[model samples]
Target: MAMTQAVQPVIRPATQPTTPARHVTVRGRASFWLFGAAACVALLVLLPLAFTLRQALGFGAANAAELVFRPIVGELALNTLMIVAAATVTSAIVGAAAAWFVERTHLPGRKIWAVLAAAPLAVPPFITSYAWVSFSESLQDFNGALLVVTTAYYPLIYLPVAAALRGMDPALEETARSLGLGPWTRFFRVVLPQLKPALLGGMLLVALGTLSEFGAFALLRFRTFTTEIYAEYRLSFDGSGASMLASILMLLCLVCLALEFRVRGLSRYDRMDRGARRAPARYHLGWGKWPVLASFAGLTLVTLGMPLGMIVYWLLQHGDAAITPVEVSLPLVLDATLSSVGLGLAGAALTTVLALPLGLLLARHPGRIATLLERIVYLAQGLPGIVIALAIVSLAIQALRPLYQSAALLVVAYAILFLPLALVSVRAALLQVEPRLEDAARSLGLNRWQTLWRVVLPLAGPGLGCAAALVFISVMTELTATLLLAPIGTQTLAMQVWADTAALAFAAAAPYAAILVGFSLISTWLLMSLFGKTAVLGATS
Candidate 1:
């Protein structure tokens, strides 16, 4: 044993080879371009905030404080907050209930009812207000405003909630039932909790929309911040006062978003079961079916049918001469239609293009920078359209005088206001594409750009299309921005309708309204179609 141990080898610790510390900076052309473009968009979106802050500060703090503390400011804030709270709650409840009836019950004509319910979204709030005001002078106050907005926005909640309900796993409900839970009990305790995200998202949209709404509140003679902002710009020419109000409105928007996130917290609703699951059983309304059907029918009548019916009635009463003799101003109508279409297409294309970089960045490599940029863009979206329009107006007059009152400037404003819509849609589409497919493409000798171009784009085409259609419809129906920034000679259908209605020219307004509704319906159909059968039916859950 001594002889065998005589030559034992000494062991040393293994060391990783110390390569020279080279400064390796790996960069891609695509990544560089994406980040740069995203940065530009974020700046573009933040310009309004920057200008508003500058203007608010330009007026001495004491002066700004005085402006904000006025009775008008408090009144505007109260009106705006009340409307936002009411509209969001009413929209969520009506939308979710209607969605439940359509998706989870054995109701007759569910398909038709679902389509009718969503059709109200095609009727712009202003147009609905116009219709209601024409039909009855009584619908011009708080109740009226609440009714119109609820009808107009409920579809936002309905679409997402319906989609969520459809996608939800049924086993949870089955398990609850097995534990002796009744249908309504299981729904409230089990299903509603799962719907929190969708409901919250839809409610957020509705709240922001009500905050930014202009024409409805204006026509209803409600003194919300939006109407006052318009008055300050148009009548008093008080830019500082308007800016002060906008700043307040912006703060309110931020608060709403913060509250939403706080209430939502960190809840997760993913299914734990790995295998395929069965569809949840639908509820049979049994003897309650007729009442449910009547409810939907009445809702459809008020939300969709009323506006449409009134449009027809006005057209017949005032449009008889025009309808019989074809004396309607064809050229003006034609020009306005063309203008609307061109602006819509331009806004949609530009917004979608701008959305791509942010969408891709957020989807692929989310970080603080990307998240902050996205949030900045959304802040602009949540601000009233008039605020963005006024900001652009002030900037154009100050620094870009030559561009003032140009159609291009108006398009930029549209892009600024609606870019969030396209961003959300495109990001959603990007999320659906599996990264493995991109990896597979790379393994086949394709570069990243080529992989994205050929594989990711095709997979996300439907969503992109949906984004375009939605933006187009939104631009078509837009009013406040177009009024303030459209070129001297430019006329959109929305503008025409607004002007004619303001003058009590119901017949003249009818054609523009009809055409506007037509385009909206077409675009809404496109949006719903791309989303899938239940896309607008509320099955996205």
Candidate 2:
């Protein structure tokens, strides 16, 4: 009886997990995962970078001299800058004010506006650009790209900035407003300054996105480093030109990183404390509501409605050009869907898990190394999928030849390209965790790991999961890298879409396109669930 009781008590302790270490597990990552992820990232970034520099240098200073001396570089540079500038400026104006209006104002349908602003994000920028190119005579060139991208990307600003504004204590704005400050003055003086970092951070995402964009630029015939690089690679088969263009892109990416830092400054913008949430006061949108509605309506019509309507219209018009399920092959579509979903989920989890370390470091250790690593991530974000794809190709062949041209290699590419997204979200969430709570956990006989798992993680865990889901959805839609890096015999929906479209079989491409959009919408719905109910918002123009 004594022995039985002792064994039973021990079993209970094991089951109950009396300590944090006993309860939490840090295992599950295989050696292949750790070494593979690290190796893949190194190979994906370094090899292409080195090879690209080699090719760029092979221009023997004469070609580069021509590049500098000629107007080609200047024209491309000006165009690039113009698009980025327009996208950034438009996104800032629309996103910031909309976030402010929704979060602070007593505007009827604030919830509705919040949903509409974010809805555009779900409609891929390229898809929007595609609609503009096909339908509107005026929507082309630099302005069209800006309009398309801004509509799609502005949500990046709205979501975070609105969240920030919602958590902001109304006391600051109220205090400012009470001091004889008019509406415009108080907003400019108090709110704008306060939201600067958030605004800039969102704008940085837009800028990098514009820099790395390929599909929209290709569709619109707008020349950019990414589009040029791809054209050189696939169309011309000129690796030299591709590398040269990629080098320019890298330079642009570095500039974007510098700008992001300048905009974000040194402040940590995430404030996810569990304390009582204070809501910002609204600026009554009485007379100003018309301008708000007009601006908002114009954007919603062009950005949201027109693109979706175009997609639907194309489907209807081409409906007679019906692609039988047998013709398109549901099995093929299923395979692509499964591949996309599985890899997207796996990559999202891996990237999110990997990003936790960097995020924690950024939150706690803001030293040069941490800053440098963070900068590297942001710089990587500006890299086109094709560049990352080409880099991985070189690295895979050289480093891990056995793993080369495998699903594992493709997943690694996805992880590297999308890791930064997970990092940003994790960092954003980490910024919200207070050190005091962690210190309190330590006082309760917990070590750093214990404190993180028991306290910090429990609080930040939701954000991490949300971040992972977001990554998964994005990778599922990713076309460029998947096109180059997906091993032989691997067929993804993105590749199928590209192939069908390239073959000029719009009817054949319809199923794949529909499937992609369906998946995108579903994934988007999942993501919006994190914030709240967000539906497609707009009126057709």
Find the candidate with the highest TM-score and give its number.
Answer: 1
Candidate 1 global TM-score: 0.89
Q: Give each model a TM-score.
A: 0.89, 0.76
State each candidate's clash count: 7, 3
lDDT of 1 at 293: 87
lDDT per residue, candidate 2, 1-541, as tens digits?
Answer: 9999979977986676545554233222322243344344444444555666776788667767765556766788888888988888888888888887778777676677777877877666656665665465476777777777888888888887887787666777778877888878987887777787778778888888888887777666688777766766776554656666777877887788787777667765454555665555666778888877777777678767887776676566543353332146568878877877787877887778777777777776556656666666654576777777766665566567897778888877777788777877787677777767876776678866677788877677656766887898788778778777777888876666556544444455556666677777887787656423111110110
Q: How much lDDT does candidate 1 score?
A: 0.85
- Write the residue-wise lDDT of candidate 1 on 1-541 in tens digits: 7655654432222343332221112124666677899999999999977898788778888888788889978888888889999999999889999999888999899999988988898999989988887777787889889988999999999999998998988888889999999987998999999999999999999998998888887777778988888888887575777887777877888898899999999988886764685676888899999999889989989988888887887777645433223235789999999999999999999999899899988887789989999988988777788888888888898899999989889889989989998998889888777777776786687877788799988888888888888899999999999999999899899998777666656677888898999999989888978867324322332
Give the clash count for model 2: 3
Q: Please report the TM-score between candidate 2 and the true structure.
A: 0.76
Q: How far is candidate 1 from the true structure (C-alpha RMSD, Å)?
A: 5.5
**Candidate 2 worst ten-residue window by lDDT:** 532-541
